[model samples]
Target chain A: MLPLSVPFIATAVLSVLGYVVARKRALSVAGGDIRTLTSLPHQHGLNTALSTLLPPLAVMMVWAIGARIAARSDVALVPENPTMVYIILIGLAVTGFVLSLLRISTSFRARTASEGWIMGLLIFASTIAVLTTVGIVLSMVSETLNFFGQYDFRDFFFSTTWSPNFRGDSDLGIIPLIWGTLYISFIALVFAVPVGLFAAVYLSEYAGPRLRSVAKPLIEILAGIPTIVYGLFALVTVGPLLRDYFAEPMGLGQSASSVMTAGLVMGIMLIPFVSSLSDDIINAVPQAMRDGSLGLGATKSETIRKVVVPAALPGIVGAVLLAASRAIGETMIVVLGAGAAARLSLNPFEAMTTVTVKIVSQLTGDTDFGSPETLVAFALGLTLFVITLGLNVMALFIVRRYREQYE
Target chain B: MTDYKISAKGVQVYYGDNHAIKDVDVQIEDKTVTAFIGPSGCGKSTFLRTLNRMNDTIDICRVEGDIRIDGEDIYDPAVDPVQLRAKVGMVFQKPNPFPKSIYDNVAYGPKIHGLARNKSDLDEIVEKSLRKAALWNEAKDRLDAPGTGLSGGQQQRLCIARAIATAPEVLLMDEPCSALDPIATAQVEELIDELRQSYSVVIVTHSMQQAARVSQKTAFFHLGNLVEYGETDKIFTNPEDPRTESYISGRIG
Candidate 1:
């Protein structure tokens, strides 16, 4: 079996050769009068190269996938016969090159044919993305079904206690984890929304161009910082500060890692997501709207409140929903700032564990794949997926409905 | 001089060092329709915006010299531009109605200015403003409908109604009928003639025929200077300036 690089190099060299040969043939057919040909020489060359490239690459991909699937069933024959695979791929490429070369005539529409190939490639790339999402959901669904089969669905969903043991009597109720997730996300949104919205308004409406140019990218830099860095900041800074300053003094809790700590840090991480998107949405509200309000003797703040903000309300709602989904799915900050205690409590300062944090802890160490303890991660993940998906769909609906309101 | 509702003396406007409006002086009278006619970028709109201090919203734009509305310097630091704009309402080149109900669009100005004492007062103001703009018949039944849902002509009238609801002493229309059809243009021209009975109406128009039809007094501006200013009939018939006559005759804009 030859190395993978051999076929790749061969395909590249063959494609270049095919391009040059096809271009020369096209020019000769035109007899130096380039306008007589339907498509340009370069387009004919590109069509020939694409014909040599796409079909053999598609066949190789299919062969590789087939071999991978067959390998799981102990059928090693296909994977071991790489020589034959290479020969067939190379033979197909050469055949395509020669066939397309013959078709490059004075009247042949090579440009349209190459464009069709590019369109097909784009569609194929998008299909891979869509199919990957489908595959993830299917896998999670099957594992969740396994979890429900082992444990009663009602107990998994309804029971209040969550205590997993190695001896098989495990109370894996999802309510407490869901409660922690929602509670933390709620706190994050409560802290982030007004601050982010104000920042967006100031940047879009009030700030001069020079200030906006400097401030907007600086605010967006918050989004570029890794979430794990935010987690560390949560663990080292915000957690201790909240524990000593508020939680312990107010008789809430003594622990440094609490829901408030994680929520505050996550909110900091989500400010850019809200501000950048809201800024763009606010800016999209037409300048004419502002002029109309201002020309009617409304002050700047009054105009923003009564006219501009209302016009951009639907888009702002969508941005907030998107940020909410991000908050709900956040895991790194929760794992570090919020302690691993899946307790159903209303006190924000109390130590809590979210669905994402529990998903990480439940599957990290040694565990049987068939056990409900390990399979429960998939259930939690599926629930989170559905929640975020619902939020995204709602956001899309709001944005689309808002678009029809204006010209 | 006391009869002039708006008076500008040696007014100059600059947009980031581009002298948009050069040294210009004009006196606009009360209860009369004064039309500013010129080709595009002739500073007609810029000079109109100065009347209500609307150009104050633009950061790069700077206005110098005196622009007084009813003997009060509008650009004075002591005067609030918000209050000034309420006294002098403006309509734009395009129909820019708020994305709101027809009732709300008209009521918005009066509501913000505290001109209405109660719901009935606000309702009366909206009805009167709509009737004045000639939009009451088409819009009265659908007061709750979105203002943007109206036709282009109706939307322009709605904007005019919005501007009039504040009960401004001076109405500045910047090509208000440019976006309208010929029929709508005629309707708006008729409405403008009626508007002159109460408020000092200043309009910037591109069509010379429109200037002749709607204006009592016409001011021809060329290259940011007032080329001619007189009665509408005299300006259209025998303009003193060659540039004004050429512009009126459709030769050099």
Candidate 2:
């Protein structure tokens, strides 16, 4: 890993050089009358500085990655594993590129030169981001295809069996895992939707300005609390509470690690997410609708129920879908709260497993590279990615349609 | 007069420290159009909103004294403002149409009050309301389309239709033609004339010409006080107040 000092130094040097060169060019273009320029001279300076720094930094990243790969192969051949040497070399490459950018900046200008280089660098940076996403998808797809070649596709999808042991005999059907995930998520949604939506409506429509000021920040603070903290809260506090109150009383399985426990905790974790999103969309509904309803002699609550809520329906649907996606992809709460048993059962008090939990289990600790158990995590990840992507696309379409109605 | 539909007795309104409406009293005659003409900040609209209890929506506003609708005190604690508003509807300065189908927009009030027993009753109410607003022919084919998709004039008429669907005994219009073009204004003025035959109509306007053309009685307000109130022809031709004369002659707004 490159020391963090490099990029900062490079950026600082490039910024100064960019300022000087941009000023000189601007002054010359305006026949020494600086006031004639349309924009501030500093904006031009920023533009030039960005151009100088971006290209070299990109090239340095590629060079460092290539060096590491080459070193990995060479280290494999050597008697001693030269991991430190590879790291040092990669670090040097990054430092050198950063220093080079620092030394040569936009101040070092040729009068004949155009801004083609800057544009190219910007395009190159953006393409790298797109290429990285595509690369991840491609890598996941290829690995998943390899896993399917060993396991039947129908069995992987439809079969309820999912015992992926590294021992000679192993079954890795994903149905039970998918079922557990959907069940837990469904429970979470049931808890989240009403409470979140009610809180949102209260905050947006009914709360006085002072109460809203206090309540909104308090809710946002829930969002700021890390998921890991929520997981621990679920595991230590809520889990036992549920086992005592719900599971034991109902004559269900008396375990703290139940789907019900995890789901309820996860719902609490997602309250801020749902409330914040729903609040924004509800606020976006024009005040005119409220006034119109009120003018027609409707009570405030009646106006909200009849006019505001209906107008904000599409956006609220979008918010719910997004919350559903968050609940599905959440890993820490389920891992810490729900037990590691992959069973398809209707009983909420029973221990259940989710896809994210299985992914963590499969990846962590030592394991044989060629085993199907190891590869299943990648397949699970690919499926999760696809599901979230589909939901987001649908949400975007709905939100766009809702916005077009008013605009 | 015994024919008066609404009577205000020493009604006063205050916004925080600013007294928005001074001690003012007026009686609106039944089944006639009464126009209140004044410049901006003259409290013409404020006085009009008092009849339907619309000012109660504002948090800091306080209304003092009595306002009676058909000889019943509307401000009585036992009386519900919702029911009062249903009987006395209002149209705002700008055209505010609900984001619903044109038919649904007109049908909303009737549906809320349970006035229609069936689909046919609702259809009848919608048709009659639209026809009364003089918007039926233009909007007859597109009843299912969104109400906001109409032209400005049509949207204003749609709001008028929505107001009339509740079968209000009195209609309060706050500068109904201010946002509309001249032709739309003319259409609305004609509709106002037609409407006065059935329901008491009160309009707050800045146009003296509109007051002359449509109203049976005209009240001129200046700086939150009623300066003159009489028959429209007499107020326009021979006013007793100097402020009214200055305003009518365009010497003062």
- What Cα-based lDDT does every candidate model obtain? 0.91, 0.83
Per-residue C-alpha lDDT of model 1 across residues B210-253, encoded as one tens digit per residue: 99999999999888988889999999998888888889888987
Who wins the DockQ comparison? 1
The regions of model 1 sitting more than 4 angstroms off are: A1-13, A27-37, A60-91
Cα lDDT over the full model 2: 0.83
DockQ of 2: 0.54
Error of 1 at B145 (Å): 1.1
Model 2 CA deviation exceeding 4 Å by range: A1-15, A18-48, A58-132
Against the native complex, each candidate's DockQ, computed on alpha carbons, is 0.76, 0.54
For residues B148-238, what per-residue lDDT tens digits would candidate 2 score against the true structure? 8998899999999999999999999999999999999999999999999889999999899999999999999989998889999999999
Write down the TM-score for model 2.
0.87
Report clash pairs, candidate 2: none
lDDT of 1 by residue, A1-407 (tens): 34556776787788888899999999999999899999999999989888888777777666665665566567664656778878888998899799999998999999999998788678767867886797699779988998889999999889998898867999999899999999999999998999899999999999999999999999999999989999999999999999999998999989899999999999998899999999999999989899999999999999999998899999999999999999999999998999899999989898899999888988998888889989999999999999999999999999998776755
Q: Point out the worst 10-residue segment of candidate 2 chain A by lDDT.
A: A105-114
How far out, in Å, is residue B16 in model 2?
Answer: 1.8
Clashes of each: 0, 0
